[model samples]
Target: MHVPDGFIDAPVSVAAGVVAAGAVAVSLRGARRELGGERAGPIGGERTAPLAGLVAAFVFAVQMLNFPVAAGTSGHLLGGALAAILVGPYTGVLCVSVVLLMQGVLFADGGLTALGVNIVLMGIVTVLVAWGVFRGLTALLPRTRRSVVVASFVAALLSVPASAAAFVLLYALGGVTEVPLGSVLAAMVGVHVLIGIGEALITALTVSAVLAVRPDLVYGARGLAAPLKLRVGGELVDAPAAEPAPAPARSPRRVWIGGLVASLVLAGFVSFYASANPDGLERVASDKGFDKSVEEHHTADSPLADYGVADITNARLSGGLAGVIGVGATVVVGTGVFYAVRRRRTGSGDGAGSTGGGDRDTAGSSA
Candidate 1:
């Protein structure tokens, strides 16, 4: 959930900002390992690094659909579970962080002042808990696609309330106004528990869909699924190994294009039907009387504020344009960040500048 401005005091917000910055720094380094070196396969490009950007755009799209969870409360995709299951944990953190950044700076969904709080709660805590639980369950369960999907479900189910609890803990330390802490905790946890069910369903479904198409690209399923076995005279034997890596079932470019199309459709059109109700956190705040302290966003007047373009009286057109713009922006920015991280893993980044300069000097001397 987006923590608007003034929900947390300046000091606590600043502290959260520092924590967020440190976590992002650590995640970036960690992500390099997950996205490291891929000699182009049939796709003929970096394997998982580019997928990070697609995942971010997909998360941004799905989050626009706020399904109703209760009478007057709706909940959207936190996406931590989905991202972690599809990509590695560190990369998952980066994915969600990118979405948060885009939403804050462009769409004005989350306040810039509370960006750190949102990232800590929605990105870091959720990814940590979801990945941990998913890994634990995967280890104990059978090595099959079913197990991965099951673990995704259970992990997603737990992550939402975990995030809510984290927010409560943060609020306890630096809430802008006094509301009954006990009541706030109970309300947030209770509502988010229901939201978690929806989260689990969405995460499981998406993970299953991806696994069916490209299990190799799925980080969590890398070693979890077993190879095919053949029955040889009543005995099961491992299938023959490939000389090189098994080829992808489909083209990576095709998958990327298909995913992008889906994201665009969902955000641009499906989001129009998303319930116009406060989410779990906002509901809790309003119910608890602490919402009065909530301040207007600095970017409230931005063209994309509240997910609509400025001076655009047509709801559908404005929202659709905004969603399309958001998806495009997220893909560009996320791809740039992931590409930089991936390049750093090549270990040639530090010397590239010097190498280029030397070549230029040599050319000049010859001339």
Candidate 2:
């Protein structure tokens, strides 16, 4: 949920900004490792970086499709679990952060002043909690595709309420209105529970879809299946592993193109059917009488404000065009950031003589 400008006191907002900044810094470092093939598989820096960018754009598009949750309330994908499962936790945090930044600056949906608050809740908190839960569940469950999908669902479901609790804690410290702490917590948590179910379904479905096509690309699904074995005479023995094949050059490109097409379609056309009711946070704020504290967004007059084009007369066409533009912008910016991080990692490896020219060639071809 996006916190508006005046919802939190300036002191608390500034403090949250510091926390958000630290989280992003840490994630950037962590993402380097993940994208560099140190955390998942061999085709990393090249493949994972572009996939992460696509994930960010996909999240941005999906977040626009709000589904009805409860009476007069709707909920959309938070995308932390989906991103973490497909990419990695660090990159997942960055993905959501990118979406939030785009929403605030271009769509004028989230507040610019309270941007830190939104990042803390939707980006950092969601990624950390969801990743933890997913990892824990995967450890306990069978190592299979089904298990990973199950873990994704549970992780996504819990992450939503966890984020809501974080917001409640923040409000307890810096709320601008006189709403009772207990009432606020109850309302936020209760409504968000319904929203969590939707989040769970979306995360599970997306993870499952990706796994069916390209399980190697799914970070959370890595090592889920044991290596192949051979039966020699009467005894079973570990099969002699074949040399690692250089990743096919066009596999990631195919996936990226497919994901981008889906994102464009979802944002440009499917979003028109999204429920018009207030989302979980907005509904909770209104019910608790704290919505009065919200200040108008400074970017209210932006060309793409509120997910609509400024001059388009048709509501559907205006919103559709804005959504397409948002997806395009998010993909470009996200790709640039991830590629920069990937390059930094490669540069460091080169300086240390840790990566050979062959490895670099493989990575480049895969990209």
Candidate 3:
């Protein structure tokens, strides 16, 4: 949920800003390693940066399609679970953060003053909880593509309520007005629980689709979907495989173009059919009588406020143009950030004069 200014007191907002900043810093470092992409070698492939960028853009685009969750409440993709399953947890945090940044600065959807709150509640908390649950569930379940999808569903389902609880705790600490903490907690959790179901379904479906097409690109499926080997004389034997050409099939261009087209379709056209009801947090805040505390966004006068371009009177065209612009900007920024991280990782490895993981790992590197 996009928390506006004045919903959270200044002290608590600043505290969250500090926490968010620290978390982002940590995530950036972790992303370097997670995205330490192998240079194109005998088993030719593309770097991880572009895929990570697409994750950010895709999250931004899907979030625009708010589905009805209750009578007056709708829910959009939080995307932590989806991104973490597709990319990695470290990169996933950055993806959501990038969307928040774009929305706050350009679209006036989230307030600049409350950016930290949104980042902490929606980005960091969701990613941490979802990723933790995913890893734990995957460890317990059978190692297969189906298991990965199941784990994604469970993790995403739990993450929504966990984020709601975090918001309640923060509000309790720095609520500007007198509100019943218990009531707020109950309403927030109740509405968000419904939203969590939607999150789980979307996360599972997206993860399953990606796994089917390009399992190697899914970070969570790494080491889980290895090709089965033969058992000979009570010993496991590696199956012989054909050598790939110099230019491997793991070309980023195909996936990138496909993802870009899908994002365009979803944001430009499909979003027009999404429910127009208030999202879960907004509904809960209104019902709980705390919505009056929200301050007008500072960027309310921006051309792209509320996901529609200003001065474009046509509802469909205005919204569609804004959505396309948002996707383009997000991809550019996300790719730049990830590309830098990947370069730093590669540079570090070169300086250290170390070959990455040994032969076994490198040989299996498919996208």
What digit string (tens of lDDT, one per residue) describes model 1 on residues 1-367? Answer: 8999989989999999999999999998777656652322233225566688999999999999999999999999999999988878888999999999999888778879999999999999999999999999999998999999999999999999999999999999999898889999999999999999999999999989888987766789876647689999999999997586666545566677888999999999999999999999999999999889988888777889888988989999999989999999998899899888866655433323323432232222211
Which ranges in model 2 have alpha carbons more than 4 Å from their true place?
Answer: 40-44, 227-250, 350-367
Error of 3 at 227 (Å): 8.3
Candidate 3 backbone overlaps, count: 0
Q: Whose lDDT is higher: candidate 1's or candidate 3's? A: 1
Model 3 lDDT, residue 296, Cα:
91
Per-residue lDDT for 122 in model 1?
Answer: 94
lDDT of each: 0.85, 0.88, 0.85
Report backbone clashes per prediction: 0, 0, 0
Model 2 weakest lDDT span, ten residues long: 358-367
CA deviation > 4 Å runs, candidate 1: 37-45, 227-250, 349-367
Task: Return the top candidate by lDDT.
Answer: 2
Instruction: Flag the better candidate by TM-score, 2 or 3.
Output: 2
TM-score list, all predictions: 0.89, 0.92, 0.89
- Tens-digit lDDT track of model 3 for 45-80: 226778888999999999999999888789998898
lDDT value, candidate 3, whole model: 0.85
- What number of backbone clashes does candidate 2 have, counting pairs of residues 3 or more apart or in separate chains? 0
